[model samples]
Target: MLTAYLTHPDCERHQMGADHPECPERLAALRDHLLVKGLLDCMQEHEAPAASDEQLQRVHDRAWLLQLADQVPAEGYARLDADTLINPYTLRAARRAAGAAVRAVDLVLGGQAPNAFCAVRPPGHHAQRAQGAGFCFFNNAAVGVAHALAAHGLLRVALVDFDVHHGDGSEDIFAGDERVLLCSSYQQDLYPFRDSHPPAANVVLAPLAARSGGAAMREAVTQYWLPALARFAPELIVVSAGFDAHREDDMGNLGWSEADYRWLTEQVLAQAQASAGGRIVSCLEGGYALSALARSAAAHLRVLVEA
Candidate 1:
């Protein structure tokens, strides 16, 4: 089976404004880099579908979800937060982003693919069940986790977030859900500033200090995430794969490199091979610097595809 690459053009349509770090150019840069590196040739590609109301309701509140739809403007942008907004295409793009994660899960679980990566954006992980922030509109990976648990009757699913910021939104949705284990690593001083916080019983944390290097992240993950994952023995692994922690990306100060991303992907992929029949669904989260994002995502994809 091949690794699946999922993306949508609408993802590029959901932009904040000119020169924003999370600009629409991110998808283009990533895609072009993957193409240049020949990573795209190794995977089976698919266009992301729009997530239904029923699908998104698994992780988001119905009222807030509806409000997101109602807030879409005809030509101008609508505000969910100072950093998050909805242009004419933001809602559709958000649905596509969420839907890509769900589709990746379905493809992996249904035996059509061994693993998958979603390249859609309006990057998630900051959108809580009832609120949106940090440029996130919907908790994409959380939606997928909920789908695997609720729709596929999966008893154990691990959601691993290695973004530069804590996956507080994901934690908020799955805090009390025992069937899922959420593991997160983030720079403590970045935006959202959810550093050194206590996680739920099912949530494992590996908070890295500002300017901490990859060794620190590796140590934290080894000390916390790996053991919990071994104990839980998840049936599927869902990843919030973000690259902003890279030293080149100024989104945070973790100072990681592309090799660190490859190492992280290796850990997740190895665990999937051991306990999940190689079932994995990884979704794009935060990676700001275009060059770093492209290089890091390519490095991450090489592991999943070549595995």
Candidate 2:
């Protein structure tokens, strides 16, 4: 079966501001690049369905979810934090972005697709179980992992994050859960900077210094992530794919290029093949520079399709 590509038009409508780096144009740029590179042809496309309340509750608190729903504005934006704001369409887009991950998991585990890539915006890795932060509302990758375990009845799962910033929100929800192993590599001193001492054994936090190049990241994956993941023997693997660490992106000092994204994806694919039945659900998280985000996301998607 081909890989499934899940997205929705509403994902672009959830905007924080006109000047925000995490704008809707990132998704547009990625889609255009994928089409131009002929990467879309090898995949099966599907529109993401709105996530059900029950599915969302598996990873997020119901009270927080309702609070977000109640806070949605009729015309303007509502501030959740200093960096996170919800516009009129923000609520719908957040649900769709999260729903894309859940649907990707379903497609991969239900045998409809060999693997899946979710290309939605309002990127979710920073959103905690009870609060939204870092331009994310619902933790998409966390929601997907929960869906695989709860709905699909899969016990062993893994989440791999390669964003420039620590996925503290994801770690917050999955810490101490032995059933899932979380492997992440991010810049050492960035937003929500607290992964230096990862709180759990299941979480392999590879905190790199500023300006750390792709080689350093590769070393972390080879030394830290590979060993832990191999022992887990997960039934499925979910990726919180973020491209903001690219050299061109000013979001962080990490100089990761498109090749790094491709190499890392291939490494994850190898692990998935060995222990997870080749199942993968990748969701978009962070990437600021438009050109770099487009190219990097394309590279990641290419590996998903070919592998």
Candidate 1 residue spans exceeding 4 A from truth: none
- What is the per-residue lDDT of model 2 for residues 1-307, given as tens digits with 9 covering 90 to 100? 8999999999999988879898999999999998999989999999998889998898899998999999999988889988889999998998999899999998999999989999998888998889889999999999999999998999999999999999998999999999899998999878986848879888888898898799999998999999998999999999999999999999999999999999999999999999888999999999999999999999998888988
Model 1 compared with the native: what TM-score? 0.98
TM-scores, one per candidate = 0.98, 0.99
The alpha-carbon root-mean-square deviation between model 1 and the true structure, to one decimal in Å, is: 0.9
State model 2's lDDT. 0.92
In the predicted model 1, the residue pairs found to clash are none
Per-residue lDDT of 89 in model 1 = 93
Clashing pairs in 2: none
lDDT of 1 by residue, 258-289 (tens): 99999988988888888999888999999999
Model 2 root-mean-square deviation: 0.8
Q: What overall lDDT, based on C-alpha atoms, would model 1 receive against the true structure?
A: 0.91
